[model samples]
Target: MDTLSKLFKNNIRQYGMIIALVVIMLLFEILTGGLLLKPINITNLILQNSYILVLAIGMVLIIITGHIDLSVGSIAAFVGAAAAIMMVDWGWPTWAAVVASLVVGGLIGAWQGFWVAYVRIPAFIVTLAGMLLFRGLTMIVLEGQSISPFPSGFQKISSGFIPDFGSFGTNMVAVVAGIILSVVYIINELRDRRAQLKYNFKVISQGMFLLKLILLVAVINVFTFMLASYSGIPNILILLFVLIVIYSFVMNKTVMGRHIYALGGNEKAAGLSGVKTKKVTFWVFVNMGVLAAISGLIFAARLNAATPRAGTNFELDAIAACFIGGASASGGIGTVFGAIIGGLVMGVLNNGMSLIGLGIDWQQGIKGLVLLLAVAFDIYNKNKRSV
Candidate 1:
């Protein structure tokens, strides 16, 4: 009984976002007459939530460090506007626009990092000022207008998909690739388990591990088959997949990642213990700025345009996703997977409500209530356990 209770607690801590995802899906699935899980909707959900998921991952790290970034949306708008101005207005190459946007994002981050890390201003104050500053900059750059008709290659950033394997009706290439991926996944899982055992960490039972593997394989195969049936998969989905792998690796395997975790857990202690707190914090915001820029560029690409209101309220969506994903408000706890799950939750809600023809006002009200409940639950759970 004690072991079971411990297992439950552990699962809650580790997989609360997953549980919430399932609950939300069920609620919407029932409400929307099973529209939520349609394969098309599923694919759309991934695409629609991709940017927020990206931002949430970075935001999770930021919040884990007991800081918040309010300027991401504005930064995104500015970056998108810059990308558009460079590509369309100035006739720069798409690649040039992309590189410049990312660089500018990093510089903007560094600018804010200067204040937060060296000047010792609170992150909230610095980013709040940044929010206002960047928004004004965006408007100035665009001069109260929108830019459009970007190059085709640039437009493909968000709208392009990989080649369809289903066109061949049982394309051997996709099947072979799927098999290879499954084998690689199994090997990696085994190696991870062995490493955990070697380090004397608590390892799950082989049965449970295999069960998880089987479920994971099932989901992957189903998804692969569906994509192969449609247009193989989206290029942006592939980008997101690569990012997940890279960020997951950084968080789990790298010394830098360890420093991030430590800093988040306790800044003063981490600083005293030689974690280079200022540099890490600076880099954290820098990374966030880069991602926000990337997000902005993608959003602009999707619309084939940039507007003054581009990315309006996007920071709220990203931060809400992070909090909903189970990152502690006080800091020091979160995961990439959790952020993705949370982003999907919001995306699904938005999509499902739209499918049911909920007006914008009602949708916002509903989402606001849900957000409130989620945060309230998190706080209540924290206090309850403290007692």
Candidate 2:
């Protein structure tokens, strides 16, 4: 019975996100008069929260190490300004401008990381300083004006979707390929379960495991059908999927990823055990910088312009999503999947509130209440465990 109780606790810690997502979906569905789960809104939810989810993944890693980055929104703003200047003022090619923007963002991250990791500055102080510094630079670059009319190809980075293979009469070949891919994915998952059991790792019950697998498969097929029914899927969505897969693998399978988690869990212990905390911290910021640059580019593309205020309050959204999704404020406790779920919850809340004709003030008020409740619940859960 104790073991069962432990299992339940573990599942809640690990899968609280999935539960929250279902509850939010149900609530929104009812609130929207059943409009919340319309296929289009579901797809819009994914696309709209894409940037927040991306930032939260990196932010959670930073927080795991007991650090917070208050400067990402500013960094994103700076990137937007720089990208605008590159294409408009400097007349750089679209690809060159994109690469340059990312590099500049990385340098900015490296600058901040150096101070925090090597100079031994507290992260909060260093990032606070960066927030002010970068915001100032952004205003200088933009000179209080917005930039627009980027090259056509550049604009496509955010706004373009993949062409429908079904446009040529429902390309049957793609359907067959998808089925084969689905089968392979299922087999791989089953093999992973077998491997875990063979190693005597704690595993979910067979019934629970099967249920999860089926649900995942169902979700995938439903998404595929939606795209197949429309103008195929989005290229940006495909790229996002690739990135998530790669990052997930890095976090779950690679040595560097292990070290990051270790450092987050206990910095002194990680350092004593030969993990290079300095290099890890530096690169974590670098990764965050790159993701921020990409997000800025996407935002610019979506708006068809780069505004001076493009990223205002974005960091708050990302941080809130991370915390709401189960990342502890004290750090060393979060997951990529959880962060994604959290972003979705926020996205759903925003969409549903807007649909219900709630004013911005009311929406913000409700969101603040939700954030307070989520964090309070987190603290209570931790205390209960300690007791």
Candidate 3:
């Protein structure tokens, strides 16, 4: 009981949001008469939320360094417009267009990174300027028109699904993959537990650990099953998964990650500790630019059009997801998994409200309320910890 209490207290934010997500899903499922979790809706939900999720991943890193980027939405829009022009107006090959778009995104990031890192400008001002600057550029590039009908191959970047060579009704491959992942998850959990014990670290009880594994495994299988029911797996979903895995690894296991956290926790101290604060901050923005570019492509591909307003309010959503996902406003604290969970919470809320015939105005109001409450919850936790 004591161990359980300690564990719960330690991870209350994560556990709380997860429970809230399940409750939200269930409530919507009941309200929408089962439409919320339908295989097709679930698939659409993922497709709709991919860009925000990608941006959230990058946003969390920036926030962790005690900074923010308001220009992501504009960056996404500008890059998408550029790519559209490359493919549509210039007749560039799809692959080359994509590469060029990502490069453009990187250059944009580097430009902002220079201002924020070297010039010692505040991130908010820098990104705000960038937001206005890039939004105008998007309109200028597209000449206030939307471009459409990308190559089918280019379209696949966002809308394609994994092929299932062997399936009966549902995708058997997805089910098998789910099973394999569950086994792997269990192995990883047990290994982690053993390592903690070997290090003489304080650990949860055996039963608690097992219960945690069981719940997570159930989630993995169920999530895959639902996706398998409609389409095996989306290409974007695969990309999101790969990204989550890579970023999570980078955050928890790498030196650069440590420097970022340190910089966020205390810029002066980090610099004194030989962290190269400017370099770290600069690189983080550069990474954000790349991710934002990637998100722009995903959005454009999903819509099959590049428009002037492609990424309206995207920066706000990404920032909101990070905060709701348990990222600290003060920096030096957040997780990739937490950011994903936060984005899903927003996604589920949007889907649920739309299905229940809620008006867009009300949806915005409710989402804003939810964001406020999540941040309030974080503050409460922070205060309690300090006490």
Strongest candidate by lDDT: 3
Query: Can you write out model 3's per-residue Cα lDDT over 1-387, one digit (the tens) per residue?
Result: 788898888999998999999999999999999999998999999999999999999999999999999999999999999999999889999999999999999999999999999999999999999999999999998999999878899999999998897548998878888999999999998899899999999888888788889888999999899988998789999899999999999999999999999999999999999999999999999999999999999999999999999999999999999998989999999999999999999999999999999999999999999999999999998898899
User: Which candidate number has the best TM-score?
Assistant: 3
How well is each residue in 40-91 modelled by candidate 1, as lDDT tens digits? 6776776777777778878888888889999999999999999998999999
Q: After superposing candidate 1, which stretches have Cα over 4 Å from the reference?
A: 1-5, 170-178, 198-201
Q: lDDT for every model?
A: 0.84, 0.80, 0.95
What overall lDDT, based on C-alpha atoms, would model 2 receive against the true structure?
A: 0.80
lDDT of 1 at 254: 97
In order of lDDT, best first, we have 3, 1, 2
RMSD (Cα, Å) of model 2 = 2.3
lDDT string, candidate 2, 1-387, tens digits:
454467778757447667877888888889889887776776676667777777777787887777889888888888988999999888999989999999988898888889888998988999889889988888888888889888888877766666544446553433554566578789999999899999998777788778877887777676566555444555567667777778778888999889988888888999999999999998888888888888778778777788878778778888888888888888678777777777777888999898788999999998898788889988999998899
Which of 2 and 3 is the better model by lDDT?
3
Query: Which has the better lDDT: candidate 1, or candidate 3?
Result: 3
* Model 2 ranges off by over 4 Å: 1-6, 168-181
lDDT score of model 3?
0.95
In order of appearance, the predictions have TM-scores of 0.93, 0.93, 0.98
On the 0 to 100 scale, the lDDT of residue 134 in model 3 is 100
Question: Candidate 1, residue 134: CA error in Å?
Answer: 1.1
